[model samples]
Target: MKQGGDLLSLVGYQLQQANLRLETDARAVLADFDLTPAKLTALILIRDNPGCDQTTLGRALSINRSSAMKLVNILVEKRLIERQPGRDLRTNALVLLPEGQRQVDAMLAAVHRSDTRMTARLSREDIQTLHNLLTRLGPATGAAED
Candidate 1:
């Protein structure tokens, strides 16, 4: 088979390029919600883990404490999420406000639209196969556990 070069043949390079495009598209789609991918992730994580704190959120998203704080602050300022006293006096539990819940649904719908557009070129079977291969490489759900 003909190949452009070793650089073009590298799986990591290809994946990185794909990720950049997807992130750009996701950011555009998320714009109407006034959310970035990190912020959207923060909201989703908080929703899924209602009692989780800032430190947990940072670790889950592979971001530093300051970065986490920035995202948290924005969400709080927007009244989309709130911080309440946690089990530990020093920690604050993150919870979505009513507005956050409504925004979450809208954001999810927008993201689904982006996903549909992105995958329009792939058949259902092809997409399934790609998902299976990716899971074998590194399962998205299990990454945090590791």
Candidate 2:
């Protein structure tokens, strides 16, 4: 029992350290693209879920509607994304432009490299174990099958 508690505490600390390192590394790569992590993430969301409305994006990103709108404004001004009127003509549907797609592809590649470097300390089996554990803890774990 004591050993299990010790292992849990140690794992918590390791996860915190890993999160901080990821934040630093992500910011460095995103800086090159003139984007913050939030912006890049919002772009990716737009790309993957075309026609998603602001409220939906806000929920997915865990950001408020205002923040989502602000990010959307930036992307629109940069010509990376555009908005279409939803069925009700009230909500705006997000769509990635060709430029947005290019940016997303580049960002994804950069993020992949960053992730590889961060996880390089782990063996392939260790990586798989970590992935499986995290998936179970994540929001979509059960929803994935639905």
Winning model by TM-score: 1
Which residue pairs overlap in candidate 1's backbone? none
Query: Count of backbone clashes for each model?
Result: 0, 0
Residue-wise C-alpha lDDT for candidate 2, range 45-140, written one tens digit per residue: 888999999889888899898988888899999899999997577898999999999988998899888888888899999999999997776777
Q: After best superposition, candidate 2 residue 106: deviation in angstroms?
A: 0.7
TM-score of each: 0.89, 0.85
lDDT score, candidate 2: 0.86
What is the Å distance of residue 73 in model 2 from its true position? 0.7
Off by over 4 Å in 1: 1-3, 139-146
Predicted candidate 1 versus true structure: per-residue lDDT over 56-100, tens digit per residue: 999999999998899899999999999999989899999998899
Q: Which ten residues in a row have the lowest lDDT in candidate 1?
A: 137-146
Pairs of colliding residues, candidate 2: none
